[model samples]
Target: MSYQLQDLLYLMQRLRSPEGGCPWDRAQNFASIVPHTLEEVYEVVDAIEREDWGHLKGELGDLFFQVIFYAQLAQEEGRFDFHDILDALVVKLLRRHPHVFPNAELYQSLEAAPPVSMEEVGQLWEAIKHTERAEEAPHQPTRHLADIPTSLPGLTRARKLQKRAAQVGFDWPDPSGVLDKIEEEIQELRAAIASGRQAEIQDEMGDLLFAQVNLCRHLKVDPEQALRSTNRKFERRFDFIEQQVQSAGGDWTRFSLQALDAWWRAAKEQEKKHE
Candidate 1:
């Protein structure tokens, strides 16, 4: 709490330095430490969902270290440092939020605002990307849906790609159409199964998941977070069932399909009632 942001970043970088520092930290690089970044994001989500402010504070600190770690590595390579990164973000934030800080009179309210459609807004974001790229390289926004990091988890990346494509009117209009597409994809997946071709089945499975991601967009839901919540829900309920069975001197391996189904249904009902 006493340290400023820069001071904390400095401390973290020092901790990762070669001389008299953490071995695990010093061994890490951008690509090698990706799972830590992903795990920290999930920890932040967990803390927020549980409303644990103390845990959130700790998780946020860990996440901050991840960023600073990357900056430190870049600093060593003379690519950029934390200060440069900070200055770039500050400039971009001020540019995007002209309505709040600057005297620049942006479109008056939502209604009085300059009638820039979503299509135009996407173009504006692209413009900003172009400006950033120019600063880094003389790069242009060659494609409408370009530059999304491939390293992103498939589900999240799929949603972002779908949203980007929708900006160019490449998306279905309604949830009904999305649902129908999902059914079509499911049929294709079943056919792939019947065909018994491994490569075709993999491709069909990817298509099915991609269709589901688009359906999530049409329904105005976050596919990745929805899937993660389902995972946690099952984890909690199954753990509860396991505990109860042990308390009653029952072995988990001895559970029949019907018995487990009954427990699972009870868990679902309990979850609904608690909510």
Candidate 2:
């Protein structure tokens, strides 16, 4: 396909048109297509992990389709079409990267402009978001860290909320301090449990996880990303175990706990050898 950036919006519209196009595409709405978008995102990550360019190419196309698919649906409903969406983003990109875009203060190299610190970059990004939203609709001036969507998965949202708050000096000074706070929260939870206070226990549990996420954030580690990577590693290791069991003429379900443990050890050893 001879796809160009300027023609992309028109392409998405044609894809969803009822006259002659994809039936699955024609039936989808923004709400109904959300899960597919999310699934495509994971597929992209999987491709990255596997280090397969061909896989990445396919997965990225799938992800790109999700965006276009949503935009097409919006056009069908008389909402802003894909071009409006693209134009808004293009404007935002130019506005945000003042260092790179012409008409802003020039740097020695394009890479060396402003936002010297990570915090400064974050401030600049948020400031642009606030400005854009205000222009779109007034009364959204106060952009709080916890304003992130509640519909996001709790663990993912927790990490994001903690990082957002920390960007504004609302965090422990060091990892050790966060570690100590985690223990304190745990102790408080225990006391709450002893007192039969369900609410207090639930609140303290959140505090504990938030503290841990803060430490992860400060250490330059994304807790959600770390967990997802480990989950992927575990899945690969377990799949290896399954393959090993099958090669030995053994059914995975028929294997005893000891047998599984032995296979797991072998997998670990193989991983270590590769390292």
Candidate 3:
């Protein structure tokens, strides 16, 4: 028999029940579950990047369970429940996609509404979000950077902050300008290293990374995704190196730096041939 979402919610409730609940589940709180939620999110992203369709469903279910867990906790506190989460999500999505739901009505037919270009859709989405933000805090001053969560991964958050600033004409005019900024940051980083001040080195390092993220943004590339791809490539090349070492009697002492360099080049050539 096929189980439904209600079944999953029931299971969560059982796990968190005071009477006979799993101790681990009962012990967890919003703060404690955050790490697990982030891990599950990365797992979903990894599965998609690997094109692991067979396991994607399981990863998605794990991510969805995170939401259910949060909802259960909120429900227990009498704040809100899973149904409320769904209602808010549906309402927000319908509000955002005005092209699809012309009257902001979920059940409205789309036959009469004219199609919108992708660029126009993006503009409309941002405009609607801006209006929503204003309505959410009518008295508070609008701060574009304030809404971005500091908990976001550094590279992702940097890109978002840059994009937000760009909307107000506060960004590099082109990728070339970003490249120059990155070069300038690199020079400052080198100077900091020469000075041998740990604090200055760390500060310059962060600036260098932030500048690189800006370069990625100006080039229309996602810095996080680009780094992930490079990480995978590094793994593949290192695996090749390990295989070579194992073949050579598993003796790292026998191979020189030159030999390892040769193996790395060979790995690159092998990848090129596959491509």
Best by TM-score: 3
RMSD of 2: 4.1
For model 3, how does the per-residue alpha-carbon lDDT over 168-200 read when each residue is reduced to its tens digit?
899989989988888999999999999999999
Q: Please report the candidate that would top lDDT against the real structure.
A: 3
Worst 10 residues of 1 by lDDT: 104-113
lDDT for residue 30 in candidate 2, whole number 0-100: 77
Ten consecutive residues with minimal summed lDDT in candidate 3? 106-115
lDDT of each: 0.82, 0.78, 0.93
lDDT of 1 by residue, 7-108 (tens): 877787788878888998888888997899999998999899778998899999899888888899888889999989998787776675543434433443
- Please give the distance, in angstroms, between residue 231's alpha carbon in candidate 3 and its true position after superposition: 0.6
Q: TM-scores for all candidates?
A: 0.83, 0.78, 0.96
**Candidate 2 regions with alpha-carbon error over 4 angstroms:** 5-11, 102-119, 130-143, 185-207, 243-259
Which candidate, 2 or 3, has the higher lDDT?
3
Q: Mind sharing the TM-score for model 1? A: 0.83
| Better by TM-score, candidate 3 or 1 | 3
Worst 10 residues of 2 by lDDT: 104-113
